[model samples]
Target chain A: MKTLLITLTIALASLSALAQGVKVGDKAPDFNLKNVDGKMVALSDYKDAKGAVVIFTCNHCPYAQAYEQRIIDLHKTYAAKGYPVIAINPNDPAVQPQDSYELMQQRAKDKGYSFAYLFDEGQLVYPKYGATKTPHVYLIQKRGADFMVEYIGTIDDNYKDAAAVKEKYLADAIDALIKGDKPTLVNTKAIGCSIKVKK
Target chain B: MKRFVIYMLLVAAVAASCTRGERPTGELAVPIVDYSGLEPYLNKSNDTTYIVNFWATWCTPCVEELPYLEKLSREYSNGPVKVLLVNLDFPKYYDSRLLPFLKEHDITAQVIMLDDSDTNTWINKISPEWQGSIPATVIYRGTKRQFFERAFTYEELVEIVEEF
Candidate 1:
C-alpha cells in the first residue's frame, strides 16, 4: 500500500506539470520551429540578443490580422534595440486551413515581413507557453543562459483601432526591460480567437 | 370574371405588403454593455441555471458550437436552464457583422454585446482561469458557478447542465 501510494503521487505530480504551461518568471522553453524562410529557427539562435518578443499568432484570426502591421512595426523598431519579435503560428492546418505553412510563407512574403514568421508545426509550442489565443504576447528576457518570461498578454489595450490605443502593454514592457527597469504592468488580457488545435 | 380575379389578386398583394411592413426588419435590438453592466447577468441569485457563453462572429469554433447552445436553450425553453450568449464582436462590427449574423442564423436566445475595452480587469472577474479566449462559458445558479474555457457539443453541454 505504501509503495502504491508513492507511485500514484509521482504520477499525479508529473501530470499536473505537463498540463500547466510556463508562467511569468518561469524559464521559457526553447523550440526548434520552422520559419517561413524554410529554415529551422530556435530561441538559442538569438544567443547574442538581450531578449525576444514571442507572439503566438495565426493568419486566419481577424484579431491577429488586425495586429499584423503593429507586430511588424514592433520588430522594425525593437530588433535593433536587442528585443526582436519572433512570431509563431501554432494553429493546426487540419483545423484551420488558412493557417497552413504554405499560406504563412505567402503572408510573410506579401507583407515583406523582416522578422522570422515561424510555423509551430505539429502544434507543439503554444501549449507549452500557455498561449490560449492568437496574438498572445510572451515577452521573454534573457537571464544568463535562460530566457525568463517577464510579461504575458495582449499587444495593447485596444485591439480595434491601433491609432486610438492608449496602453502599449507589450511595447511598454520591452521599453522598461531595455532601460534595465522592471515593467510595472507585467500582465494584461484581450479578446482573441482561440488557438486551433486538432481534437 | 377575369377582371374580378385580377382585382382579388391585387387585394392579396396589398395585404401581403401591409403585413411585411408590420413585421420587424430582421434586426434584433441587443443591449451592448460594459463589464459592469454584464456582471449582473453573470451573477443572479435566482434558482435558474444561467449558461452564459462568450463568443464572437469571427470565432470559428464559437460559431460551430453555437447551434448546440441554441439547442440547449430550446430544449429547456420553459425549464430552469437559461442560455445567455455574450457577443464579443468589436463595437464597430455590431451593425455590419454581428447583427446580420444573428439575424441570418435566427438565434433565439438572449444575446448582449460586451464592449468593454478593459479586458485585463474584467477577465479575472468572470473567471481567473480564463485566458481571454472566446467560446468560453460560465454556468451559474445563484451562488453556485462553474467556468469552462472550452467549446462544447450538444451532448456534452447537456451532460454538464444536468450535473448542475
Candidate 2:
C-alpha cells in the first residue's frame, strides 16, 4: 500500500508539471506573476469575473508601445464588464534593460494602466500559452467544468497606423463572451515583435 | 490537522515562487547556437543556387516570409537548391525564445541559428551589396546570388525558388 501511494504521488507530480501550462481545451495555467504595483495576481483570483484577457506585453518594442494606449483603453472598457485585461511581460531584462521589473512598474505607473501588468518569472509561462508576440492576446472562459482559451491573436487589425483599425479583434471577443455568445474568431494570425522568452 | 498543515505549506511555497514574476527576459542562457559549421556552404560551396535569408525574433516581416521558404523547400524536395534561413537572433534568445516561435510557425526549412554577432565579419561574407535587414532573401545559382529585401508572395516565392 505504501509503494502504491508513492507511485501515485510521483505520477501526480509529473502530471501536474505537464498540465501546468495552457492549451486549447485545458484549464488556463493558473499563475501568480507580479503586477506592476508589486502585487501578486492569479488567474483563479479573476474566476468570479466573467472572463479574463491576458496579453503578453512589454515596455519596449515599437509594436507593443504602439498598442499601449489601446491596451489601456481595453482595460477601461472591459474591466467593469467582467472580462478584465491582464497583461503579462515576457521579455528578459538582462537582454533588454527596458523590460526589467522596476521599469515595468515605472511604465505601468506612468501609463496609468488600470489592469494587472504581471511578470512571467523566468519566462516559465510563455510556452504554455504558445505566446510568440509582444502583443499576443488570449481570451479565456469557463462554461461548465473547465476553463478554456476563447481567442488568441493580434490586438486588432492595424499596427502600422492605429487610426486604420477596421476590425477590433479583442473588443469583439470580449463583447461576444459578455453577451453569452461563443467568440466568432478563436485563433488569428499574429503580427508584432516575437516574444523574447527568458531562460 | 496534519493534512491541512501540509496543504498550507504547499500553497505557501507555490505562492512564493510564482510571485517572483518575469526576470530580465530579452536574451537567455542558451546552447551556443552557432552557424559557423554552415559557413562553407556560404563561402566556397559550388551549389547551383544558394538561397540565404536573414531573420530575427522581433521582426514581423521575417516571420511572415518564413512559410514561403518552407513551402519552397518542400516543393523542391528532389532538387539541389539549398535554402539556409540564417537567424540573426542572439544565442540567448534562440534557446529561450526562437525555438518556441519556430514551433508555433510550423517552419520546416533548413533553419539555422547563425552566430554572427560581429556584423563586420559576416556582413561582407554574404554579399557586399547586402544590407542586414530582415525579409531579405538571396538566391544563388552557381556563381550567381540574387538578393531581395521584401516579402515574397506565394507566386513570387515559387518564381524565385525556380530561378535559383
Task: Tell me, by DockQ, which candidate is best.
Answer: 1
Q: Pick the candidate with the highest lDDT.
A: 1
lDDT for B103 (candidate 1): 89
lDDT of 2 by residue, B122-159 (tens): 54466654433355677776667676655677788777
lDDT of 1: 0.91
lDDT of 1 by residue, A1-199 (tens): 9999999999999799567788788999999999999999999999888999999998999889989999999999999999999999989999999999999999999999999899998888887898889989999999999999999999988777899888999999999999999899888888788989877
The CA lDDT of each predicted structure is 0.91, 0.72
- DockQ of all candidates, in order? 0.64, 0.03
TM-score of 2: 0.54
For candidate 2, give the docking quality class from DockQ: incorrect
TM-score of chain B of each: 0.82, 0.71
Angstrom error at residue A131, model 2: 1.1
